[model samples]
Target: MDEYFERRKRMVERLKDELKISEKVAKAMLEVPRHLFVPPHMRREAYNDYPLPIGYGQTISAPHMVAIMCDLLDLKEGERVLEVGTGSGYHAAVVSRIVGEEGLVVTVERIPELAETAKKIYESLCYDNIKVVVGDGSVGYEELAPYDKIYVTASAPKIPVKLLAQLKNGGRMVIPVGDFVQHLYVVDKDEYGRVKKRSWGAVRFVPLIGEEGFED
Candidate 1:
């Protein structure tokens, strides 16, 4: 337990230095036990800064990526957020805490097994505000439309129109685009339905497979 706390503390410090995120966000990162989100066999490396495979050909994103994406989301208390991939539920859990209970988070995952595992972890962590759905995440969850923020964990060949349509005017979305070399993009939707895009940096992520993504 002491070692876990120490490693978590280091992760917080790294997030502060590397990502330049606020201490409040760092506090949330420190408080959340990432080990609980990974498979038992891989728990030892939970605090490491690298992504780890979590079955289903998916990976729990690196802590730096998580922080960067969350920072990009620019979440506010009581804001409704949508997450494209739940993975191990770590990112969704972080978002859940940042948005608070009054806020809502709907996370979609294509794989049923991963979604089910993430749901169990979210429940165990008492993250009641996060809702997990097993489906094609690239299409976005329209039932909970007008989300204040949207985050896609997987890489897409192009921005999904469905996801852009789901964002509330003035809302922001962080997504990675490309196959071999992915770039993190910030997409903002204006009230007039105009969309603006900006690139943050380079990243590599698993391909997003769905209606708006890869054919196979």
Candidate 2:
């Protein structure tokens, strides 16, 4: 655990130097034990910048990607956040720390196995602020509609209106949009419910598959 903690500090340093991530995001990234979310065999590489496979043909988003998304969303303490893809639960775990105890992180996972594993990992870490839900994440989780912020870890054919509708007024969302060629987008919803978006840069992510996303 001490070794992983040191690795996290180094990782955060790189993120700050490379991406200019905020202190809040950096602290959250450093605090979450990424090694716990990954499979036991892959724990050694947990603090590395790249993504690692977590079974079920899905990969955890790279540490850099997670840091960038969290920065884009501008997550604040006591805010409600929605994560479209739970994956290894590492991303959600980082988010949980930023949001703090008053805030909530509802993460949706398409694969039942992955969702179950994520839930177990959250329990082990005593992360009560995050809830792991098993469902099609493309459509967004309406039960907790109107999130203060939202982020999708996968690439979609286009921005899902369902997800946009779930973003609270004056909220932000960051997602990867496109098929063969994906680009990261930062979407903002104003107080009047108007939405504006701009491309951040190109990125590669597993396809978001469901009703409002790619055809599975």
Candidate 3:
């Protein structure tokens, strides 16, 4: 446990320097027990700063990518955040830590099995504010519309129009768009309802599967 803690510290340092993440995001990364979110067989590699398979054909994003997306979302306390993929629940845990008690994190997983696994993890982590639901993430969770921040862990053909509608004015969403090659895109909706987008270079992620995403 001590060694994992040390490795997490070092990983955060590297992420701050390499990914240019803020101090707050770095702290959240260190605080989340990443090992708990990884498979027991792969726990030793939990803090390696690389993506690890979590079964069900899904993989957690590398730490660098996680930090970059979190930075792009610019989450604030008490803000509602919608995560398009729960995976191992690590990213949602990190977001939960940042959101604290007041804020809510609604994470949707397409696989029933993964959603069940994530629900248990959330209970163990005592993330009462986080909700793990089994559904089509590409369509966006409408029950809790108007999210302050939205993040899609998988790559899509294009930003889902449904998701954009879910974002509150002045909110932001981070998603990777493309087929063979993907580019990380940061989209922001302004106070006046105007949207601006910027690319954060190439990235690779599992194709987001659903009506708005690529055919699985």
Q: TM-score for model 1?
A: 0.96
Residue 82 lDDT, candidate 1, scale 0-100: 94
Q: Which whole-number lDDT from 0 to 100 does residue 77 have in model 2?
A: 95
Candidate number that wins on lDDT, 2 or 3: 2
Q: Write the per-residue lDDT of candidate 2 for residues 1-216, one digit (tens) a residue.
A: 588899888999999999899999999998888889889998889889898999988999889999989888988999999999999899999999999999999999999999999998889889999988899999999998889999999999999999999999999999999999999999999999999999999999999999988888
lDDT for each of the candidates? 0.91, 0.93, 0.91
For lDDT, candidate 1 versus 2, the one ahead is 2
The C-alpha TM-scores of every prediction are 0.96, 0.97, 0.96
- Evaluate model 2: give its TM-score: 0.97
Sliding window of 10 residues with minimal summed lDDT for model 2: 1-10
Q: What is the C-alpha RMSD of each candidate to the true structure, in Å?
A: 1.1, 1.0, 1.1
Candidate 1 per-residue C-alpha lDDT over 98-185 given as tens digits, one digit per residue, 9 for 90 to 100: 8989999999999999999989888887889999999999999999898999999999999999999899998999999999888999
Candidate 3: TM-score?
A: 0.96
For model 3, give the 10-residue run with minimal summed lDDT: 16-25
